[model samples]
Target: MTLSVSLQHAFPGVSLDVRFDAPQGVTALFGRSGSGKTTVVNAVAGLLRPDQGRITLGDRVLFDAAQRQNLAPHRRRIGYVFQDARLFPHLSVRQNLLYGRWFAPKAARRAEFDRVIEMLGIAALLDRRPGLLSGGEKSRVALGRALLSEPDLLLMDEPLAALDEARKAEILPYLERLRDTFALPILYVSHSPAEVARLATTVVMLEAGQVTIAGPAHEVLADPTGARGFGQREAGALITARVSDRQEDGLTRLDCGAGPLWLPGITAPAGAALRLQILARDVMLARTRPEGISALNILEAEIQDIVAADGDGSAVLVRLQLAPGAGDKTAPEILLARITRRSVSALSLAPGLRVFAVIKSVAVAPGAVGPQAI
Candidate 1:
């Protein structure tokens, strides 16, 4: 399913004018607070009408200003998951999940109740009430309820915002499963770079009510020039890898285009595909391969591009193409390094220069890794 949106809405100090296509899988609307992320979501859900625009999901027209067509929220067939679970406190978990069925027509209900419960791992909590559930548990139940509705698309508005780090970690796997297992497209709203790096297939970056960048998650995140939006410290590269083997020293080896990356013990099976987020700030560049170093990851890379330093001129962002074979014109894999401007001048770094990107094995956080689609 594809969701195309062209919207223009205005308020006292905010005027939103944006257009983007959300393809199947998770399309994350990413930006800071009050970036009109939720406004765009609301326009899709029919909760807020645009001053001028059109929203089409596949063949169905959800809103069209020219035609004066607007579907009611209930009739739009889009499941919404908010930051708060919004489950009925008095109702049992099962009851809360089943309640979504009330809005879904009998003939259109395609999501199996038992399957949703199992997918979200909420079968154990079915008999309990929302008041007694943990934050993670409530989010799962809420997700189950949304899935049970059998909507054409899913709208998630920062679903993890209300959870603490532990709860957020607890619920991330379920969300990943939802993306991998379901056919429905998801329009997810979040400001978190880590979440966007892990969950998003497509990222539409909004700033001050406008889309500053829109493209594949990896490409958008890898742009050194776009680092300001994500904050220099949080900017990074996303790499696709497969769990190749586990070592006795308590590390899981992943095979990527750049070769093996040994991370802290990953519980997934050897063949599982995973996505890893490597922060630019954690990477160090070397003109010559350094030996006898504690860092386990050092890949041969060529300078692809160098972005000018920020206002303070204290740092420079460099893009590196990793594992470029002999006579190979295109580098399929890339890594990012943020270093001092003085280092750039000292090494005389320029495009096409060969260098090594050194990364510490322990620098990668467990939360920055997640399952990728096979």
Candidate 2:
């Protein structure tokens, strides 16, 4: 299923003219603050009427300004998970979840209550009230309630924004499970590059009020000009990798376009496919392979392009394409490294020049690695 939206909304000084289709799996609305991420999601959920445009899921028309049709939010069959849990304080977890199921049409009740509880790992908290649960627990309960509603499309507006690091970590795995298991399309709003890198299959980036960029997660992140949207500090490349082996000294090996990579704190089992995020700031480049390097992971690549900051900043983002891993025939993947303009000049780095990308094994935190959503 796909969600097509074309919206035109004006808010005094800021106006939005946005359009995009959210395909199956998680489609993330990624951009800086005030980028209209929430506004677009709100329009799709029928929370607010756009000045003009149409919104459709499959053949159903949820909103059409020209036709004077505006479906009620309750009738739209879209599950919304806001930044806050928003569960009924007095109700137990089971009661809150069942409350959502009450709105489902009898014939369309496909998400069973027991299955949702198990999937969200909320069975233990069924009898507990929302007030008694931890932050992560509350988020899981809120998501479970939405799933129990049997929604055709799910809308998440910065669902993890309010959680602390621990809470965010605890809930991320459950969120991944939701995306992988659910066959319906999802519209997720997040401004964090790390979160977007973790969950998004398709990414639609909004800026001011317009769609600055939109495409598959890896392609969007690898866009050389994306620094303006994702910010220079957050620019990175998302690579598809498979766990080749688990090492003896607390490290995991992954096979990717960069060949074999060793990373710390990877808990996934061997043969598991996952996504890995490499921040530009974490990558160091060398014109030639050095012998006494302490970095465990080094890949041979050719410089594809170089992007210098628009202003006086000395930092530049150098794009590189790595050779495919052994027995891997897919196209080479892109990687980005941020180095000073002086370093670029000293190294004589330019497009088509071969170089060695030294990636610090410890720089990739456990949070930077996520399950492959496709």
Candidate 3:
């Protein structure tokens, strides 16, 4: 399924002019609080009407101001999960989930009730009430309710925003499973880089009521020029890897384009695909391979580009392409490094120059790793 949106709306302080196509998998509408991320999602959900342009899900036209066509929210065949669970306070979890089936046409309700419960791991909570469930449990139940609706597309407006770190961690795996198991296309709204890095396949970056960037999540996040959108400190690269082995010392070895990377506290079985985030701030660039270093991860890389120092002129961002070893040229990967302007000048770094990216094995926290795309 595909979602196409082109909208124009003007409010007091925000004027939104956005256009993008969200293919299968999660497409994250990412930006700050007032960046119009929710506005775009509301438009898609048929909750807010745009003054102009069109919105289409596959062949269905949800909105077209020029054509004088607009589908009411209930008729749009779209499921919405908000920041809050929004479950019926008096209803049991089972009843709350089954409530969605009432909106789906009998012929269109093909999503099995039991399957959604299993997928979201909410079967055990069926007899419980919203007040009795934890934040993560509530979110899962909310997700289950939405999935059971049998919508063509799912819209989540920062569903995890209200949760704390532990609660968010408890729910991420279920979200990943939903993405991989279902054919449903998700339009997810989030400002957290970690959430987007973990869940998004496509990323649409909005700034001040406009789309500043939209593309593959990895490319958009790794773009040297787009560091400011994601925040300088949070800027980083995503690597697709597979767990190759678990050492007796309690570290997991992953094989990627950059060769083997050792990470602590990873319990995924060998051969499991994973996505790892390497934050630019945690990387160090060296002109030559430094011997006898405490850092356990060093990869031969070539400078692809150098972003000039930020507004404060305190640091520079460097983009590097990992060089594949002999007889292995198919795998390609990119890494980003944030360093002082003085270091850039001292090393005389430039595009095409060979260097080593020094990374501490423990720098990649457990939260930075996620299940890879199936």
TM-score of each: 0.97, 0.97, 0.98
**Against the unseen true structure, what C-alpha lDDT does each candidate score?**
0.90, 0.89, 0.90
Model 2 off-target regions past 4 Å?
A: none
Q: Which stretches of candidate 3 lie over 4 Å from their true place?
A: 329-331
lDDT of 3: 0.90
Clashes of each: 0, 0, 0
Put down candidate 1 lDDT per residue, 1-374, tens digits, no spaces.
89999999998898999999998899999999999999999999999999999999999999999999999999999999999999999999999999987778899777598899899999899899999999999999999898888989999999999999999999998889999989888999999999999899999999999999998888888887556678877899888888999999999999787778889958889999998999999999999999988999888889999886478988888998898445545447878888998999999999999999998888999988999853
Error of 2 at 313 (Å): 3.9
Q: How high a TM-score does candidate 1 get?
A: 0.97
Work out candidate 1's RMSD over C-alphas: 1.7
